[model samples]
Target chain A: MIDVKSLSKHYGTHHAVDGISFSIGEGEIVGFLGPNGAGKTTTLRVLTCFHPATAGSATVAGYDVFTQSEQVRAQIGYLPESVPMYPEMRVREYLHFRGKLRGMTREQRETSLRGVVERCWLGDVVDRPIGQLSKGFRQRVGLADALLHNPPVLILDEPTVGLDPSQIRETRRLIGELAQQHTVLLSSHILPEVEATCQRIIIINRGRIVASGTPEELRERVAGTSGLIVELKAAWTEIEPALRGLSGVTEVRGTPDGSWTRVALRAAGDQREAVAALAAGRGWPLRELRREIATLEDFFVKIVAGAHEAQTVPVE
Target chain B: MRNTTAIMNRELLSLFCSPVAYIVIAGFLLVTGVLAVFTGSFKPGAPATLRMVFEFTPYALAFIVPAIAMRTISEEYRSGTIEALMTAPVSDAQLVLGKFLASLVFYVIMIATTLVYLMLMMVYGAPDLGASLAAYIGLILVGTMFVALGVLASSLTKNQIVAWMIAAVPLLVFVWFSGWISRAAEGWWREVFRIVNISLHLDQFNRGLIDTEGVVFFLCTAAFFLFLAVKVVESRRWR
Candidate 1:
């Protein structure tokens, strides 16, 4: 339902999205994983027809984002990253306003309003002014606004941002349910959020796609190693050299934190036991020593380390 | 268009829902009431006419209309709601027109409240219905042009205070230029200044005359500003 060909967007000399091309199939939930300012928002803005591409082209639901923007916008429901809303408006009224803007008739809007309110779990705050609601509720209100017109394509920019853990789970479940009928493309900086909801993941960095595959493929190809985060009270200067030579230790990255120091040690597997033992042997006070989860930073490190032939954009 | 009306409806709802609109309207009523009515601009024995209402209302509207329209587009930009709004199926023209018409309607509502003075005049004396009606039409035309200009200013900045200043500048020029028109004696420059002298044009309307020239000026001024506002809004897609 979405096709992008060498899409490039530049703000003056700065290339926000540089010649990145990717397509999403019908009824597919695609995760756009990238760090903040990775051009993810810029890419989605082009697809939503919020901004014209500086180069190349994109089409959403078979309509050109540049030329046939109204048609493209009609087919796609977008939740912008910031989730801008009319604070003074009630949830139902805001959705109704959005529905009207999408050219839905009064009856259509009312029906869709009812459906989105229930689906987005906005029934409690439906009558409250949006500004009065919590950030989580406001995010749901934005989601409900996007869903009110029932567009076939939904482009959500960090849809789960600012929500509590439980709210995040709810949003994920809702997006999963939506994928059965709607072609979903959601962008996020969090590794687990995207992995949880998206069937296929596109990992982008510095305005280019660095990797694309299933979560399982990502785990097998990259993340085959483990790292430990060791934080302890010690002389910052002596921490790295002291821990860099342990068996299976390949990389030691450390930074000073007052008298305490935090270090990330990349090793073959399960390095927490080794790191704890080293701290004990050296007589450095250990505050916290834990294995690193497969964070985005770790994912990038693995991709950069293993895939020299993968044309990876250097981690700047 | 449906899109245009939808935007306009939202704008009107927002205006009515806020206390600021009521405060501005009340301030307008107070100023116009103090200037034209309760203060004896139209004395008891003074001819039964709404000339005083027409005389000062344009200036009252000049300031009041900007305050009404200052938030029309700028608030959307400030709140970042413009992204959601522009991304909708609505066209730029529809959005601008909707906002333009909303401010004009607010102007009408505020200007219309002064009609109570007209009703009072009619009760005590003989006010010409057709002339008073023509004068009110003149007021509406002035408001339409001012609202269009205010919306254009709103499109120029995300700051409502900046928008208010920008909206007031050309209006200030017109008010000051009205004097320049009176000074220049029968020349092309005078005609140039006269074309821009809204007070002179509105004065013709106050006299129960709706010249094609004045009507065309109001419409053309409104159209020019609204067209610029649309261009300003549409420019965002490029940037």
Candidate 2:
């Protein structure tokens, strides 16, 4: 649904988005992951035709963003980072105006209005002024405005930034539901939100895509191998060597907490059965034993740290 | 064209829904009515006309036009709604023209309220019907030009106060001090200043004369400023 090649946006000496290339297919929910000021929003803006690319080309729904911007704009529903809205207008009034602005006929708008308000859960607040609503409601109102036209592609930047925990979970579920019919390209710095909703993740840093893959793939690639966390009613000195002595255990690090020792260690593979056997055979009170799954947060930290190291190292 | 009309509708709806619009309308009616009575030197048995009101319309609009036009684009730019509007299926020309048309319509409504004064004149004394019609036309023409100027100012900056000053200061100078500037100039300069003077363009229309030159002058000037506004708005992409 969207294709970009060597896209760059420069402001004087600063390259806000520098020669980034990526593509999103139809019915794909792709997460654009990056740190703050990493040019994620800039890339989204360029694709939405809100700003012109300084170099290279991009197309959305088979239309070039710079040359054929009108057609491109008609094909995409955009929710900018700030969630632009008119505070004086009511929710229904705002949606009606947005629908008209997007070139919907009165009849079409009237029909879509009901579906959109229900979809975004804006029924109770539809008659209230936008300025009087809470931040969570306002965010959903922005989402509702985007969904009004039912465009093929939805571009959202930081959709769940300021929502509470429940609101964030709801937004994630909403995005998951939206992925069934629409191509979604959402950007965020929150790693778990991306992990929860996106089919694919593209991590960008310093105006470049550092890594792109599924959550499992990124974990295996950056974290190398998985580990296990074992808590036992034993001292660190005893538990560490015992875990290291197991067949698949390659390394062990342990810390004594109160009356128990928590041992974290890496292994060759499938060390769960072997560790359980070892704990059982040792006759040590096993408080807890679980495999430590590497999360996206860990992968993100490793990728960013590696990128920083690579930048700091000088060529020999 | 449809997009332009939609934008105009949205702008007008937003303007009317605000308390500021009513205040401005009432203020225009009060100021123009008082100025008409005082400047016309109304007294018992004296022939009453809207000549004083027409004479002061240009000056009145110089301040009022900026207040109305200042928020056309500047508010959107400041609030980041311009991003949403520009990203929608609307062109730069459509946005500028839509805003200009909305302001013109609002100003015309304000001018129409002053017709009560004209009715009072008709009941008390005989007024020149043809001259009153000409004055209404002139008021609209000059008001259109000022609206375009105000839009151009709005496009240049995100600050409404700055936009108002950018439009009103130069307009105030042209409406009140152009004659002095025209007199100070010599030979070709004097004629050049007079040709560009707004009051000179208004003189023919106020005197019950509807020449093609006066009509074309205001039309072209309004068009020129609207064109500049389109350019300023389009420049956002480059930035």
Candidate 3:
């Protein structure tokens, strides 16, 4: 539903979104992940026609964002990063204004407003002024405004940022439900939220896409080897050699903790059986033994760190 | 056009919802009323017309109208609502015109409230109805020009106080200091400033003379600033 081709947004000499190309299929929930100042918001703004690209092009719902901004705007529902709202207006009144801006008729707006108010769990605060509502409620109001017209494409920037745990969960569930009918491109600096909510993730750093894939795919690609953490009531010198001698064990490192020692084993394949046998043979007390799979957080850190290092390295 | 009305309606709703509109209106009425009744001695056998009200309105509106118009676009920029509003299915022209109309409506209502002064004159003495109407028309035209200029100023800055000063400085020069500057010059330089003098153009309307030149001057002034306001807003997409 959205296609960005070599999109570059520059503020004078600095490119906020630099030659980043990505697309979202219809009805797909794509999480846009990046640390702060990673051009996530800039990309969304370019797609929404809020800001024109300095170079390259973007199209939404088959309409060019630059040339046919109104059509592109009509098809996309955008909830800006800041959740911009009129604090003096009531929740319903604010949504009503947004609905009208979306060109919804009176009856159409009323019906859509009812649906979003319920979907966003804004029923209780619908009558209250936005300034009086809590941050979570205000965030929900921003979401409700975006969903008021039922646009086919939803562009939400940091949708669940200020929400409490329960509200975050509910927002995740709502986005998951929304993916059934609408294509969603949401950005969040929080990785776990994206892992829990998005079907696919596109990670950007320094105005470029550093990685893109499913969470599991990213984990596998960035994670080189499977490993195990073993704690035994033995010295580091005693445990390291025994694990190193085991089959399929590539490397072994140990840390001494007085009477107990912790051994971390990196292996080419499943070496848990061999380590367990070695522990049994030694007649040493085994406190804890657990296999470790590289998590999405680890992969994200490695990828982002690599990108940051690449930029900082001076060229000849 | 529908989107324009929607924006205008929302802007009007926003204006009335806040205390700023009422406060500005009350302040405007007080200034104009006091200037008319006390300073000008506008009473029975003393012209007994809205001349004093019209005479001081341009000066009053120069300060007060900018105060009202200062927040129209600057507040959107400050609050980040400009992103939300710009992302909507509306043209830049529509947004500018919508805001212009909202400010115009507010000015009309504020200026309209002074009609009671006219009613009081009708009760106490015979006032020149034609000149009174002409003066009001002039005030509306001048008010339109100021609001447009103020909206343009607001579009340029995210700070409301800065927007107020940006617009107020030019207006202050035109209302209070233009003729003084013109008198300091000689020959065509004096004539040039005289032609651009806001008060000179407004006085024609106050004397019940509907000069096409004066009407066109104010209309062009309003149209030019409004066009500049639209350009200023649309320029954001580039930056």
Better of 1 and 2 by TM-score: 2
Off by over 4 Å in 3: A12-14, A231-250, A259-261, A277-288, A303-316, B39-41
Better of 1 and 3 by TM-score: 3
What does candidate 1's lDDT look like per residue over A1-316, in tens digits?
9999999999999999999999999999999988778899999999999989999989998899999999998898899999999888888888888887887888998888889989999889999998899999999988998888888999999999899999999999999999999999999988888889999999887788888877887766555567788898887678877787778889888888888888887888677777788889989899988886665556765444454543653322
Model 2, position B68: C-alpha lDDT score? 90
**A243-266 per-residue lDDT for model 3 (tens digits):** 878877888888888898888888
Worst 10 residues of 2 chain B by lDDT: B40-49
For B96-159, candidate 2 gives per-residue lDDT tens digits of: 9999999999989988998888888787888888998998998899989999999999999999
What is candidate 2's fraction of native contacts? 0.68
The residue-by-residue lDDT of candidate 2 on A107-191, one tens digit each, is: 9998999998888888899999998999889999998888889999999999998899998998899999999889999999989
Best by DockQ: 3
TM-score for each predicted model, relative to the true structure: 0.86, 0.89, 0.93
Off by over 4 Å in 2: A225-292, A303-307, A310-316
Which pairs of residues clash in candidate 3, taking residues 3 or more apart in a chain or in different chains?
Answer: none
Interface RMSD of each: 0.9, 1.1, 1.0
For model 1, how does the per-residue alpha-carbon lDDT over B71-171 read when each residue is reduced to its tens digit? 99999999999999988898999999999999998889988898888888878888898888888888899888999999999999999999998998779
